[model samples]
Target: MHFLSTYQRIISRLLLVSSLIVTGAMADEVIMPPAVANTASNNVPTVGPSRPKNIIIMIGDGMGPAYTTAYRYYKDNPDTEEIEQTVFDRLLVGMASTYPASVSGYVTDSAASATALSTGVKSYNGAIAVDTEKRPLTTLMEKAKALGLSTGVAVTSQVNHATPAAFLAHNESRSNYIDIAEAYLTSDADVILGGGQQYFTPTLLEQFSAKGYQHISEFSELASVTTPKVLGLFADVQLPWAINDKQAHKLSHMTQKALDLLSQNEQGFVLLVEGSLIDWAGHSNDIATAMGEMDEFASAIEVVEQFVRQSKDTLMVVTADHNTGGLSVGAHDKYEWHPEVLHKVKASPDVIATRAIAEDNWQPLTATLLGFTPNEAQYSQLQSARMQGNEPLSIALRKLIDIQSNTGWTSGGHTAMDVQVFAEGPGARLFSGHQDNIDIAIKMFSLLPQSVQTP
Candidate 1:
């Protein structure tokens, strides 16, 4: 009898592991582990903690620890002996695991991670607030709207992108851009600011106008938006990178505008601000652009931090969905990494490469944009890459930058690494220490006026 009981227990454990490994379609057959199963009753507080009247959640897409560390060095004062601390350093409270549902393996995509962060539910890769079985999960933004609180999303990417889509809409796949864009018509977000003008049709614009939304396409027009409901699409797609942007601190500027509009509601508000292009720069392995994006994100954080300090009744949480590109400081067994080399770059590699390709005397143009002239070997490398096409030339330029700066990258994909969590103001203590990505949302749910029941 003892032997039989032991054998059965072993079988149960294996079956549980197997179930998690299976696709989302089969995940329903297995019970969740105790931690996730008992989360609502055990961790989600209802009455004890001080609930903030307002909440601000910021996501620095694909920013890992290395990215923060790199940013600190990138912005360091060479003349000063000690490295300058960045905004991320002052507010960091803890770390969070960014793994997706068992079906998608350990590493997570933006869609799944965003769903986890926004809805406090684990889902398969590419899912937009839908569970493994394609069931729509209620998001925190939806909850905020239901409670008659103000809600808004500000991002560098299109407002219909995965991160924002998870919070505002439910879809089977993030690639369904049109569906996601259409869903925003009823999202009830008061301040919608980002790119993707190509997705919003004339009919949709008319509908938005009928709904009392003031629409504008230029960044300057944001200053004249006095109405609480506004739609600002600054680019046809994702906004230009910070390095190439005409306006300095574009994300910070947008965040300030959103805050100005959302704060008008006396019932409180929930704002989601995403530094969306950090992930894109990481994916391209463009160190210069990545640093520029991080700078913009940091500036935005500073804006939110000041608001939190002033409001006192507000809580602000900042974190990343996942680490992209497996970024490392030093490569090829080098003892030193030089972030200062990147300080000279004035534009993204793609732009530099494209212009270089067009110019007959490409060396002068490349040197002007890069802030430094290429050596004989790098010149040969760029010439060889230029023979192929713009993309290859851009890749070659990035490689040259990597060599000069001693930057390292594992892959042009997401990594199963932990991301940092930074918080401030009321209810910030709850996010301190280590937790899962879903736990971040769960804690935020606890701070709401009402409890969030487990689904």
Candidate 2:
């Protein structure tokens, strides 16, 4: 009888150990800490029946829930017992579907998704601030302007890029950069800060100056210019990835500048700030670049949080236009995550690609960037690709890194996954629960002061 009892105990103990291992493996796939609950009873504050005097909408381009999760783990090093809370974690209101019009299929592009968020209407892919039929639609910024409030846009990408362009420029196609730049002359946004200096030629600069707009390129010029109507073109095209250029004009600095100028308007302001390169990083499948961009974005949110505390009447909403890369945290081994390995990465794939293509060698560059020598198979594949000279070096490097890190990506394009939405201050309650992307714009319009609600 004693022997039988002992055997049963041993079996029970073994079963428990097996279960624990399974649970640990599952947990490793999603290294993010359990969400800090933001229930209405505890998390949300009591704001009475008052309309917000100002609205600031921040878009984390291509920032899906997975990106947020990956960033949280990356920033906090989730392997530790203590983890820090990200700004988005504290303010998470709800999730929003990112599907566009049926004609555009299930996965919405940046242009279509941004238009939906800006104008409360579903539009085909590639359409910018226009309906499916290519008709111009009034945007939240335009409405805010009509209501006598100042408006502005700040982004990490070119100002004429799809996401930012959807907010202020109406075009049949998002690729029409020249047309988009021309629209800015009539946009009358109080402040415009970003790259795309090439889009605004010398002639356009003179035209802007004639219309009481101060155009500046250098960061110093942007800082010193006190003019309310300012145009800051910081780079010839899209700004360098955050990881590549730390000293360049950062998104947080640009946000602060835009706020400074827009606040000068007594009638309040509506600003759209986008962490545009988060999408690009995802597209490149570069985890290091994504982390750098997310860190900058979090810094910008911190600035906005400070602004919200002081103003008390500002409605701040943060969301993503779409999910890019379909990035998954872990792949080969369910019980493993290697966020720390990302620290070893020093340069973006683009930089490495440029060098590798120039030198006609990939092994040395890959070793330097990844902090390890490539294996026999990787070296052979790279050599063959170089011999062929058809595949992009960046693409080849990204594939190699993806395998090395055990990171998984569905494609080099956007995904139809629902993205996170976080809101704080007046009318934040409207943002809770599952919602369509268009619902955000509708709710914002509804919350506008009654006097300025009309077109």
Candidate 3:
């Protein structure tokens, strides 16, 4: 264990050195795979070209470097020796530090990090778009709306979730669901998508409708929302896990639809698209569900990548608010992490456990959902957990998968780890190298017209 820790430290130092060199070398240009580089427009300059007309901020909630690295391994083709680069790998230009205000400690909740990313100001944990004093801070979305450019949010979680809420509203606490939901009523954002139908009442729905926003509850209803203004709530609180959900690329679909609507404005738009549930999965230490969410998020990034490439006047920045779960690729002093075992997982552990608890023929049901029969020891663990309750059974299932995959997690909460940042299109070069979370929002503010920027 001592030797392994030493080796890991050495590798981390080497990675840091390599990162510095790559960042310095690519400061003036967007570095992508040869295939992607060839297709990029020559007109897209790193700097000096006028600011991008459109800006797309994609936040993968709780996605740290570990998550991306794990995704690479999980998605790798075993048939080939060389690992394939994901959309994240291709666009990754730099990294960012995620720390909230000093009052809240180094680790940040989704709300504080999102506040910093949206308002260019550090705020205490649980703060929405408010600073430590609970005062309102002008968010990027508000600025875009004031500039007469379209603004919107599209996320897999409720629109009022911490990340999206910070961009759209000002509140002292992220838990103020009613207040945040009501704040959305007054926001001029053209597109609002996600869940949280429980927070909105009949009167609030009528108010949104009166404000010219087309409100819909079903995912299928997205097509009928042709107007620039639309409110989509797909679930009562948050969407289902991607592993068990029928809509495999829900985030990608929502992002595409958002772009379609926001692009109608001649002045361009500023859109916030969040893979919100990646955090939730991470909190549960659910690797199978985490990979599924990452895949959906990656697909969404590809959609935006294509849009930015085609438009040439747009900037797309992808990052995470903070790290969650302290996820490690390998666990239990094992040198190997088998991502193949996770690929066969048909449903989340919770769902599998719930069904197993309800069904009489539980063994086959569990095996089918897990895509593998448990060994004698694992079977005993499952049986023991089954007697306890659904939650324990779920934990046991996760443990079995972790034992097979060799995955490790240190916490069920946020960590003080830096997150990777991926960018492309005009003004993208500005984000190269390491930066504080607030710096990300400040840099984006520079991309906006000077007239509307706060002094």
Candidate 4:
């Protein structure tokens, strides 16, 4: 009897091992989407020359570690294996701390963090390319322009927004949109593409034209323009969220256009491209919107990756200003994440809020955005909040989605958490390991001609 039982146990162990192998194979069959898959095929090249001639800085605002992990899971819902590789996966060299000057508090805002990335100076929040004393500082783009190289800024938000503005304009306040626009007109930047038509009046457009800039409002016009200097304003304010944007130009298209224009300079160029809406989505704590924005940003990165492959002399550095919403994937009692639920979300919280106000209905808006009809009590609470005009529609929508999706957020504001930095091409090695955000600007400045280096 003992011999028979021992033999049976051995057979059971073998069967278990076979079953595990089959499950692993089944998991492997669940391939990643083409968008997030590794396209380079492990052909990432090493730095050929001493220093890169051109530098492209891409900022995905509020893209923290959690955001990347969530995006990977959302794109490829693996049951056993790790999430599929993204464009960033191949280039990730280090992480950076994003704290600003003491005057700005511990959690840095876009302006201060971008200032650190552009000028290598830590300034208070809302101060663009300025020191803590409000003194203007030279930026990487300025150095590029001074060296007779081209410069540009492209973004999914207003051209005068904090991130892009820090590279081109110096002001004590980021909210000075008109002043920022004026500064852009007088700057040496060759290409500027983004929203914020409201900030650029007929006078400013004439100024741009007088400066030999071809101002374009439509994507078709933007694509056809062969001018080295182009200004594209696609919307009145911030551009539409990716999930709701259908008519406007995509971020990837803007990035390609910027690259085409900047590459015209034989001496090389410095360009900043920002995925600004990712920050907005994080602030709203909307997972679906965040996923849409992240996907769009990744697509932009793919475009830049192709450029990096072809132009070996160009260096690309991608990082974030800070984290927002304190986003986490799992919830209490839930060991698994349901990124698939994000697909059912139809619109951003901004869209839902606008529609609710315009149509004077909350039930259908909630159902449409959250993919579930609210209970009678829940509907009444939303209706009451909307009627009172005290509770923000975004907060209400976020609360509802949180309850349904099991996603968690600590706050609606920024966090001091360190963000990832991915770099490739010449000088990419300098960005590896833990460092402060200002180190990026310092290293890029070191690579420029000595004559253009700030004292």
Candidate 5:
């Protein structure tokens, strides 16, 4: 429990620091205990060179300052317009950098960025966690296992997607789902969680009873498993977001279970958690959806905090690969129906999925929740799209914005600008400067005991 007490003190320190800063007070530090916080006086310690016993990298896909700020604002102020300290603000470290391999006035896709962070080397866009020749490189996960430590990867994305796939599977192309699935079977990562169940299921949808690998498809089935090498593919693909929940799979549940199973190994572990839908909502330019995704991630962070604050040697690096959609909070409230009307809509954003339930029902649903009288012209457009079996949340959101406020920018793609990184733990001091995505691997290994270092 020594580690637990130290971690709790660190979290409390962070909370105290943030609360102070939010109140317009500036303090040099919140003063955590010697074991929990990294002070300049204790840069080089006797704790095996500040190596971490456990590591967690949380990725908020396509989440940059704009998206993060908007979420923080709404979360801190759901009422008046007073935003609180950002999650980054409470971290021991913060920095930013680009996602691409070079500065050619270009932007990067998820694949290149994922490879860069996983392999400690940058590659062209669309490449998996491999170099130009397609040669497989050792990732942080692979290295951790090589040193007799356990590793795990969890995300809200399909397990075969670029981000999660980077940690385990290595191939020339990130789009090769079949190849990625094959790689997962041989990875050293002990606890694999999240979607892409169909990739392994043959035409007959076989179970672990018929395979060389252990597998589970339902949350209950997952919670009941006890095997060392377990893969919980909870959905055929990306599980529905919390708002929809048609599939009823819980992302936080999967993450918690992975942490519990991996932490039992005394050799230590490294885990990755991602809220992949933040990017999806960004692509659709939908604030309501993005806000909900952020809320879900916030809850997940709370879960990690409980465990993180218990382990003195664990480190948490929460970051985003890149920014999407140039999103900005509206500068003015264009809707004039009255504060009470807007309050109702904000209070029950759940009315959205209810809007999505039927053929032509979404129009009235959005109109009602938006505090606007139903407009025949707009309803006609929505009805036509629904008649053609299309449900572009973007259209409804655009209409909502048109009625409520002026949307400042537009996009469905990544920004050339850099993304932020936030770190918490003993040696988090290694994270303060602007850095390449590739440095993440090197810095982490530097924090680990020499026995755990890869050649």
Candidate 6:
């Protein structure tokens, strides 16, 4: 009897592994409708097209550990009205390292990390795309522009925020909003989209106009400008979230529209699309807002996927700069699954006053507070401290507690945790195993022709 029981347990373990492998591979198959076929020209040099005609880099600015896991629950849950497609799904591979040059630490601010990702070098936090001496660093966009390629940047946050500004702005300080706005004029980035119109007032507006940039403030005006070069800024700062700002317009619409206009140049173009608020959601500890941001981020990914499918030469890279909130997951099983938990996570306004909260470790307090608490199976473990006590920040978040059913966090912060990177196209195969964040810039630049290697 003992022998038979041991044999059965071994079989169960193998079957579970097999199931996971199959599910993972199957989920990785993200089919882009045929519209993506011509994203890069098929007929190319025998040596291969040295440069992609179009490059779309999608960044989830504040998406750290907590955000990733929380969204996974939403996607895995069949009860939701909208299906979530995380950019990670497209990843043929992954990595967990996002360290800066100065040292190894748990939390590296977005400004420093983004600067490294954008310019291929690291600097202290709060520095834009500049080196330690406060000198400007030439970014990939600058290199592309030097080679006559067009460029554009789009974000859901203030255009000059740490993530988006890192691509084009080179300032001693990332906080120099006014100067960062002015730098856009010199970028030669033919296309510029997103908010922060407030930065481009009459004085700055005149500068762009003088440089011969066709600038517009409204979506309708965008169509009329009809210039080979276009610069569109819709809001004074970051555009409103799709949920909170539906009265405004859609992010995917802006992304698709930017691609439409930028693709006009046969010389090729590079565009950066960011879902900045996923990070904000982590900071606020607002689960619903975070899910909303993930859905929006997915729409932007669909746009890139569509583009990638059309163009064989185009390499679409989707990744987060770092993981925020140390996001993690509960062990998956029948014991923790609950549909009512989804609506339960709302963060406290006090979160802003402080960056870390130990009690919000992701277990669905909503389930506990609602009296649905864990089943007898889970309670046995909790009683032993395998799980912590249930603690909900507020009634809003409490409702979601039952759904997530997870708990464990050192603090509310970005982990030195390695972020995931997904790539698809001709040279995408080069991405595998672990690599430095700066390696992304190096690998991408290597594919460019010699003349553009240094710009």
**Cα lDDT tens digits for candidate 3, 254-333:** 89999999999888899999999899999999999999999999999999999998998899999999999999999898
Clashes of 5: 1
What is the lDDT, from 0 to 100, of the residue 153 in candidate 3?
A: 92
| Per-model TM-score on C-alpha atoms | 0.89, 0.85, 0.89, 0.84, 0.79, 0.71
> How large is the C-alpha RMSD of every model relative to the true structure?
8.1, 14.0, 8.6, 15.1, 9.4, 13.4
Off by over 4 Å in 5: 1-49, 78-82, 103-105, 203-213, 246-249, 331-363, 368-377, 392-394, 398-406, 452-455
lDDT, candidates in the order shown:
0.86, 0.80, 0.86, 0.79, 0.66, 0.62
What tens-digit string does per-residue lDDT give for candidate 1 at 1-455?
Answer: 11233234334433332233222232122223333334334332223335688999999999999999999999899999998889999999999998887788899999999998998777899999998789999899998888778899999999899999999999999999989988998998999999989999989989998999998999888889986799888899999999888366779989999998999988788999999999999999999999999999999999999999999889999999999999999999988999878988888999999999999999999999998889998899899999999999999999888988999999899999999999997767667778778778866765565533232
| Clash pairs (backbone) in predicted model 2 | none
Candidate 2 is scored at a TM of 0.85
lDDT of 1 at 387: 91
TM-score of 1: 0.89
lDDT of 4 by residue, 184-220 (tens): 9878689998899999999989989998998988766
lDDT of 4: 0.79
Q: Write the per-residue lDDT of candidate 6 for residues 227-314, one digit (tens) a residue.
A: 5566678778766655454344456866787788778867677888888878876654555556667778877777778878887657
Model 4's C-alpha root-mean-square deviation from the true structure amounts to 15.1
Which is the winner by lDDT between candidate 4 and candidate 5? 4
lDDT of 5: 0.66
The TM-score of predicted model 5 comes to 0.79
Better of 2 and 6 by lDDT: 2
